[model samples]
Target: YANSTASGGRRAHVFNCHTDLYLEEAERHGWLIQIKSMIDLFDEGWTLRSIRKRLKKDPTCTIDSLGSPSDRDITPLRQGPPQDELPDFTLDEMHRQIVKFIVVDDQAINLIECPEFRRLIRLLRPELNDADICHRTKLRELILNAF
Candidate 1:
């Protein structure tokens, strides 16, 4: 037995909605739809897998695979990568290139928008050696705004 019972007034670990499961459950009852990756669900909240699951009456959000509430009750997760772990931007005049990359590559822009990215720049500010401070500033500003 699945420890769950008929949906009407049944208290169980999970529900067996039996139809349009995802769409109907959230429509009728309180759904704790947890978002896992903002990037994954950027344009649309539902994916192909989610859509298929919805057809099977699994419309509500995935029960967070994350563990007990108290487990996360201790502290919020950190926002970005560690400060010290960024790659050394050591190639001669690489600042110009990285700034150019920031303007163009969406992925690079995502990385640069990170607070860690911001921090890395600040950390290495003294060592930047003035390849082109104006260009670097413009690039940083562009990245931050796009973020």
Candidate 2:
């Protein structure tokens, strides 16, 4: 009864997709697909056992089943391990390493000439044509010398 009103002892809430409020609500609580899945399950008349089995298989398929967020004060999620911390490499050092890594494979040079990849680049920024990327990378040595 997702898109239904409550006439027989049930409550009803309205959601307007046209507004940013709908987007915020969905974003605030992650698992955008779960909402649609639940609606579809309701429409298909899924049993509680079937729903439980599906939820067990994919844990992210349900909301916080034990309690709602409002039921308790929230705590910050855990951070990564100490080893996961950022390295202390300098910008220039990182740049040099990146360039070395890229140039190791000559195939990367051919990637610059790819039509589909060039289309993607142009789509990202229409002002930046295929020649822009190809010329920039190819003429890097000269450009760096000029700088």
Candidate 3:
């Protein structure tokens, strides 16, 4: 029942998952495991392309070689400690964020419409009408670096 209300805007988060264990758990927990389109993944709050890119970039998390059409059960490939921390991630959510990143990188970083950035700039600079472009740019870079 989401509408165009401001509060209804997306809340993006960066998430990583035990892709293999995740799909398996889907069957266990009865979460939706139906094959979905890349766009569906993005709509689910993920960057489908980024998921692929992440798997390619890092081998340990590549759940499946092919996209949604592939029915093969993905093998678990955890390399370190078991992924149990609750930093804010689910298997589907992980896919969503990665799919979102494919289309939008800022949203992937959870920086879209950041309140802190807006508050900081208003509090520190207050006004930057082309006069403090260089200073503002450097300051912005510094803030990003702090993250």
Candidate 4:
């Protein structure tokens, strides 16, 4: 079992295959109802089939799968006052940040070529296409133009 607490103090308990069977047994004994009342929580669209599919794909996957906890731990399934929508940054703003990282932080211009980095960018800006991602040459040009 894995427990996660959201920023809003909402706690989610994720049970593995073994714990899932235990929950079934507990429900048979009328314990699940009591547990549910105490937690004031219900399912958030995760069905057994979906869980199995996830487990099949990634045996170590967590239900609160946001990203690696090293980067950020976001609980998208929490119940609370809806999170404020983040203001969208324009393409220029994104390019500026990239340039800043490359120039100020001495980040490699080729960092954008990393698959994980590209995946993160896609996740953050789903509307952008592959062509929209600036390559190392474009980054070099951007640095030259900025200076």
Candidate 5:
């Protein structure tokens, strides 16, 4: 009776071991398939945004399955409070820095007047608009005062 019981326990253990191995193999196979699909999408020139949208629609797909840090969604830095809410001293310092850039770089006063330049500046500092930007005359005055 003891020998029969021991043999039955061994058989059960062997069955469980096989089942676990099979499950592990299946998981690995699925992961490989996901990786291949991602690679294929890249080959097709799919942008990260497009891929992310597709993943959102597919319940089974995950961003992690891409396995690249560059593929991950990046959060933009938090913008500071609007300049109107800032102290006068802070605004003065900001203007001084702008004047310094123009003087140090030997940039033309008219550079600030360029539509594209203003657009780029606004893009970087959303709080600033044309009115907040120093005019060429004001910039010139600041430059002269510094010397």
Candidate 6:
């Protein structure tokens, strides 16, 4: 009987006494199989096989390739705009943003809030009110006449 509030959002990891305790074994084994399958496919390629043969050794691990470079060269790409030097992008500053990007004509806007159109739409989908077949068929006739 585990209490819901006892752990305070912490997860309980129960260790198996008889078997391996390393939690990351399943994740590592999956990655190992994926990498081995990729390598097997690479070995099947004639060009890659020839390259491997020319090297006279199995491919070295590429996992360490992205480690810190020995060269002390560091290039800073734009030391970001100083403090409040950047423009304000908050909603208050963007009051005119909608007007700048959107241009809706009168007819399209009128259709959205038109009473007649709303009534027609409600009649077309009368099943929303759980109306019977006869009532729904009568509403359909009125909806067709409105157009």
The residue-by-residue lDDT of candidate 6 on 56-105, one tens digit each, is 43344222222322232232111212345544554323222222111111
What's the lDDT of the predicted structure labeled candidate 1?
Answer: 0.37
Rank by TM-score, highest first. Answer: 4, 5, 2, 1, 3, 6
TM of each candidate vs. truth: 0.21, 0.23, 0.19, 0.39, 0.37, 0.15
The lDDT, on a scale of 0 to 1, for candidate 5 is 0.49
* Span of 10 residues, lowest total lDDT, candidate 1: 1-10
Per-residue lDDT tens digits for candidate 5, residues 25-57, read 323322121223334545555434455455556
**Can you tell me which runs of candidate 4 are displaced by over 4 Å?**
1-88
Residue 6 miss distance in model 6 (angstroms): 63
Number of the predicted model whose TM-score against the real structure is largest:
4
TM-score of 2: 0.23
The per-candidate count of clashes, in order, stands at 9, 0, 10, 0, 0, 0
The TM-score of predicted model 6 comes to: 0.15
List model 4 lDDT by residue over 1-147, tens digit each.
112212111112323335445334333322222223223223343333344345456766654451322322233222323337743698877886687555433356677788899889889889987778888898889966864
CA error at residue 45 for candidate 6, angstroms: 54
Question: How well does candidate 3 match the true structure, expressed as C-alpha RMSD?
Answer: 14.2
lDDT of each: 0.37, 0.37, 0.36, 0.50, 0.49, 0.28
Candidate 5: residue 73 Cα off by (Å) = 50
Encode model 3's per-residue lDDT on 24-129: one tens digit a residue. Answer: 4333433332233323544434443345455666676443333442222233221122446644644344334333332222222333235664455346445532
The residue-level lDDT of candidate 5 at 63 comes to 40
What lDDT score goes with residue 3 in model 1? 18
